[model samples]
Structure formats: C-alpha cells, structure tokens
Target: MARKASLSGFPEWLPAERVVEQHVLDTLRRTFELHGFANIETRAVETRAQLLRKGEIDKEVYGLSRLSAEDDKNDPNALALHFDLTVPFARYVVENAGHLAFPFRRYQMQKVWRGERPQDGRFREFTQADIDVVGDGTLPFSYDVELALTIADALSALPIGDFCLRVNNRKLAEGFYRGLGLEDPDAVLRAIDKLEKIGDEAVAKILVEEVGATADQAAAALALAKIRTLDTSFVEEVRALGVEHELLDTGLDELSQVIAAASKRAPGKVMADLSIARGLDYYTGTVYETVLVGHESLGSICSGGRYESLASKGKKNYPGVGLSIGVTRLVSRILAEELVTAARSVPSVVYVTLAHDDSWHEAQDVASALRERGIACEVASSAEKFGKQIKYADRRGIPFVWFTHDDGTHEVKDIRSGEQVSADPASWAPPASDLHNTVA
Candidate 1:
C-alpha cells in the first residue's frame, strides 16, 4: 500500500512499493538503451530566463534562492527548478553542439518540479523519462514515427495493460482551423484540447465568445476534432470536410505516413487521434498523446512532439522528435489500482542464521561465500535462537534460511516450505526466478 505524503504533492512510497517503481525505471532505461538512446542528466535548476524562453510557464516554475538571499531580488538571472526536461535538453544540446554527433539520441530520467494543484495522479514533484533524437539542422519526419513505435514497444514490455499512442500534426490542425476562417488557430486548438474535459457544447461556446469563431466555424472545428481513425481513413474524412490549405495538405500527408508506418510496425498501439492537441506551444509538427485504455481519467501517460525551433545557436537549429513518460503518475495509478506488486520487498534471497555470539563470524563466512556466487543475502543481526532467526527471515520475506552445523557442513531451509537439505555455500543457489525481485 502507498502511504500518504507528508507533503501533499511529493509522494514517498513504502519499501515494497519502491520495488515496483525501481523496476519501472530500470525497465525503461534498458528499453531506451536498446534503441540506442544515450543516457544523460542535466542540473535540476536552470536560469529563470532559460526556462521561460521556451514557453509561458511562469506560474508552474518554482524559483530557487539561498536562505540568506531570499530577499535579494536584484539578480535578473534568478535560478528556478525546471518544470520539464525538454527545455534543459535543448540548452544542453546547443552548449555541447560542437562535441556531439549529428542526430544525437539521448534519454533522460529525472525529477521535475511543477507548482500544479495535487490530484489523483498529478504532483508538484515527479519523475519524467524523455527520449529524443536531435539533428544539427533539419530533421526528417521519419523520427516522429520511430518515436511513437519506440514508446509503444517500451510500454508494451511493462505490466501496464492496453494503451494507445494518439498521433496528430500541428500543421494539420492549424491549417484546418485557417480553412475554417479561424484566424487564431492556436486559441482554437487550445479550446479544442479541452473537449474531453468540457463537453462539445462548452468548447463551442468558448470558440464563439473567446476565440471569435462563428457558430458554423466552431461546429466545423469540433467536427474535425471528433474525427479519429485507426488507419488512413482520417485523411479522407478530413477531405470530406471541404477545408483546404497548402499546410493542411502537408499535415494530412505527414499524418497519413505516420499512421501507415504505425500500421505495419505497431498496429493497434497507434491511432490517428485528431483531438490530441498537445498543450505545449513548441510542438511545430507531429504531436502525440498516449492514454491507458481503461484508465483514461489519468490523462496522458506519455506525450511529446516534434520541435523545429526549440534549440538553436546562431543560424543552426536542432530539430528533434521525442516523447516523455510521467513515471510518477503511471506508478501512482499502478499502486492505487493494485495492478501489480513485487515478489519480495527487499533484495535479499537468503538469510544466514546465528547460533550464538561466537557463530557470528562463521555466519559471515557463509554470507561471503553466497555473495561471491552472485547471490544476494544477509547475516543475522543478533545471535538469537534458531526459531527466532527463522521467524525473522520469514518476516523479511527471505526465501532461504542458512544454518551452519557444529562441525563443518551447512544446511539451508526454505522458509516457505518444510524443506531442508545439506548445501554448500560455494555452489548452492536459488532458482533463476528467485535470484532477483520481480513484478507480480
């Protein structure tokens, strides 16, 4: 079970729960590395200007300052905790552009701070796993499809059930809005993005009153947003709407290619979700939002898009495609829903029993032998009775209890069963499945 956080948004898990979280991190790292993403980490703090330069996220940024310098407001370049990894990565790439290879593949897993209200899966502090491929000048759109496929492959390896990676193109959306005579396409996209939260009727009202969309234009925008398909049928559906623009044609073609590649590479895991308007402004082309099939209320478990202008030095631009998984949110849902659990809380597979105070050294020898054989174990803390030591192993969920006889032989007992056998510390080992903690 998960414990309530002493601080509302900063979650602290019990030892058992931590096993699941650690497994998730390790799995994601392995999956990303297999796809050739080099792991890197940036400082937790970036200059306030550097963070805000990427987007208007001032309200969510937490300003950093020294205890004694709290009142010193004269510094123009104040430090702040980064709200996301993408911005810092952009900065890092530009600073290290000279040393890095073109189309650099990187994976970053780190904690990010955001001053948002706490809710079921939302938090002020959370871990984000981001993978991106950045190019020196212009990046091909093929990476967009690759990112979606990679994320689907990674998530499929986890215990999380079914999920869908919703793909859309910013150019397609903005182009379609322009065809509808909606001059402020971004405002229209923002309003449409809330269609799931606020009903279609509410979104239409916002379009008319706030975004200056005519009733007909609002209806058309909503109609386009409602168009979702698993195949290239979305292209025909958008064409049926009778809206046309050069950019819209380009977006439709790009999205169709993505859907086509996904069909051959990762079917069912990818879909053309027209309503997926990522809230981030930097997404210049393809955008993605993923939701667990049964847990849609948890919102997007993974999201990101292509950014053509986020990272630049002088005339050089590092265009890239990426995706970020909200590690904390996904783990929170897994625990709250009791989706899975660890085989054992601690990593110890064997516990060495102590017969007496003098036997402690002998038990240490046994533990050393087990460690050298690539087995995880521990020695009894005190020279308790045999029954008390066995009980301690059982309580700790250690599978085996080792006993050293008065002479020279050693015997190990399976705590879960009444099975005892003579064994040698140098050769005995548990089954392969019991060698390490696993998700159950």
Candidate 2:
C-alpha cells in the first residue's frame, strides 16, 4: 500500500484554527452588512476568455480538461478557474445588468484559485472577503475614500494588530512618470512594483535597460516611489520633485483628497505611499495595500482599487471602487503567531459524565435539560469513574463537567478553575461568554 502525499499550497485548517477563521469571516460579514453592502455570490469557474481578459493572468489561470471529450481537449476557449473574485464579479454585473440596482453595493466572500507559484503567506487556493460599490456611469470619488475607511474598520474588528492601509493613485504615478519624459509609464510602473523585492539599483537598471528610460528618468521614478507620508503632505513632496503635467496636477489633487478623507475618518490607519503600484491596468484611480504593523514581510493582507470600467455592456460601463481582505493569509498568520485562540476545542460547554452504566438515563435527562436551557452539553457514552470523566472533560478543553448524584441532585464542576457547585440543569446555565468557542 502507498502512503498519501500532502499537497502543498492547499490550506487545510484544524478544528480550533478553523474557529478563528470563521470568527474573522463573521466579523467581516457583519461589518460589511452594517455598511449597507448586500451579500452576493459568483460562479467559481469562468470561460478562459473571461479569465484572461485582464491580460496579465493568461499563464496564471488553471484550464480544465474533460476526460469524456478528448477531441476538444485542445480547445482554446475552454473553461478555467478564476484566479480572483474581481474579474468574475465584473462579468456577473454585466450579465445581470437589468436586474441589479445601480450603484450596487455588494460584499462577496468565497474561495478563489490561482495557478501562480505559492510561497510564504501566498497560496494557490485561498479565501477572500471583498466589498465593492459599482455605479452606472461615474463612480463617486467618495466611494474610494469610503472603501478605504471600511477596510480599516473591518481589520480593526479582527484580532490582527495595527496595520497600514497604504494608498496610492495610478494616475499620480503615471502622470509623474510621463512628466519625467518616460514613454512607457505602465512598463516603468511594473518595474517599480518590483522595487521592494529587487532593490532600488535593480529596478533603476530595469527602467534604463528594458524601458529605454534615461538615467535621470530612472532616478526620478525611484525618488517618487520612495515617498511615504502619513497625511496629505505627499502632494507637496511630489510637487517638490519638479515634474509638471496637468494630469500630474489632477492626480495630486485626487490623491490629496483621498488621504485627507481617510485620515479624518480612520486617523492613523491609512497612509500615503507612492510606491504601491497595484499591477492591474484597470485600476485607473486610487490603489490600496495593507500591511500588518510588525509583520510587513507577510505582504499586503488586504488590497484593491478604483476601476473606471469594472464591466461593460455595449455603451454602458460600470465603474467601481472596492477592497479585498486576504482571509486565508490573515488566518495563517494568526495561527502561527498565536494571536488568538478558541475558548474550547469543541462547542460543548459541559460534559455530562456517567457515574456508571445505570446513570446513563439520568445523564441523558440532565443533558437534555441543559440543552433545552440553551447550554451546549453532551452526555458521556461510557460507564466511567468520576475521576476518569473529569480527565476526559479536561483533555478536550470542555470547561465544565456535570455529575448526577445518587440523591437525585446535580453538581457542575469547572475544569478550568476546579470549582464545583450544586445546580439544577433546568435552571442553571453557563456564562454567556463561555457558552461557545471564542476567538480570543
């Protein structure tokens, strides 16, 4: 017999850890809904054409092959798994254009698959919590600021520590690059995006060698990317760079408004970072990236941007602004750092022990009574000694152990504090805090 092989990049959480993940998701769902974003779901699979419409993810999409039909295996327009939720959401908006209300605010939480190589904190299969606001023709710039504040609020609710929601405008970067006499701003943005991974020297070399940029152009781009400010001072910093273009001026104004709005709403949660170039070409306005305070190496745990045309049906275009929380990555870091923990391994708050085989009937009665009172409990199956039952309850992290006495009285013992007291299952109940597994 052959042993099973554990595949990499596919995350499988243990029971206790899964509780934490669920808690985070629940918190995000509640926050998004409270902000008036309705729940929406999209299909997991998409046509290869739809998946690859973004241009960059052609090789990063997983194509399907049907064993039943071998002749059409080479079909170019076959099905593929969506690498991200944004692309699928765009298609869905167009498909259901007539039914959906304009300025649609939706929150989608689902697993998205990517064929890219998995690394630390990066996965081939992961979950994302996304909230997007799409409008008919022109989306309000306030939507951009609103989404950033919403992400900050959602992250603060979770157990993840302080984070930085770095905000940058693509228009700002492109306009500045053009003002510096760079012909290919997008190509330069791509190289500059690699600035952190490969050092400033390597990125500058790429700009001059590959993008046909002069030494001065490469130097100016590096200088622009190095700017980081906590407020609207980034506008002045860019102005001091000596680049002048009407587009650049417009970008500065847009970025200043976003930063000022975010600072007023979220205070220190949002920062102006010129280096953040979200690689997607569709992000025509503000782009975002969030980093856990001390865990910067884990990369952005949440990110997204404002797109002018998230979807199009003939002449009608749906522009939107949104943000996505990388749920799987955040949970992985939480487990690894021991940042939070479930109150109990099982949802069972009380373990009703059997004094003997004959006590099964009474134990069952007590269990039923406790459950009727909204207390989570279970009756021990075996006919075990009282000591053994305590150990059994202790092993599984069940906080309380219930024992029925021969006198027809009942006593509940708290395994955590070792405090035992007389109680009636019909009247007595566990504390609301300890009733269920808690992520603490």
Please tell me which predicted candidate would have the highest TM-score against the true structure: 1
- C-alpha positional error of residue 175 in candidate 1 after TM-score superposition, expressed in Å: 1.1
In order of appearance, the predictions have TM-scores of 0.98, 0.94
lDDT of each residue in 157-207, candidate 2, tens digit only: 999989999999988998999899887889998998998899999999999
The pairs that clash in candidate 2 are none
Q: What is the Cα-based lDDT of residue 322 in candidate 2?
A: 90
User: What ranges in model 2 sit over 4 Å off?
Assistant: 1-5, 71-77, 358-361
Instruction: Give the count of colliding residue pairs in each prediction.
Output: 0, 0
Candidate with maximal lDDT: 1
**Candidate 1: C-alpha lDDT:** 0.92
Off-target runs (Cα >4 Å) in candidate 1 are 72-74
lDDT of model number 2 = 0.88
- Candidate 1 residue pairs that clash: none
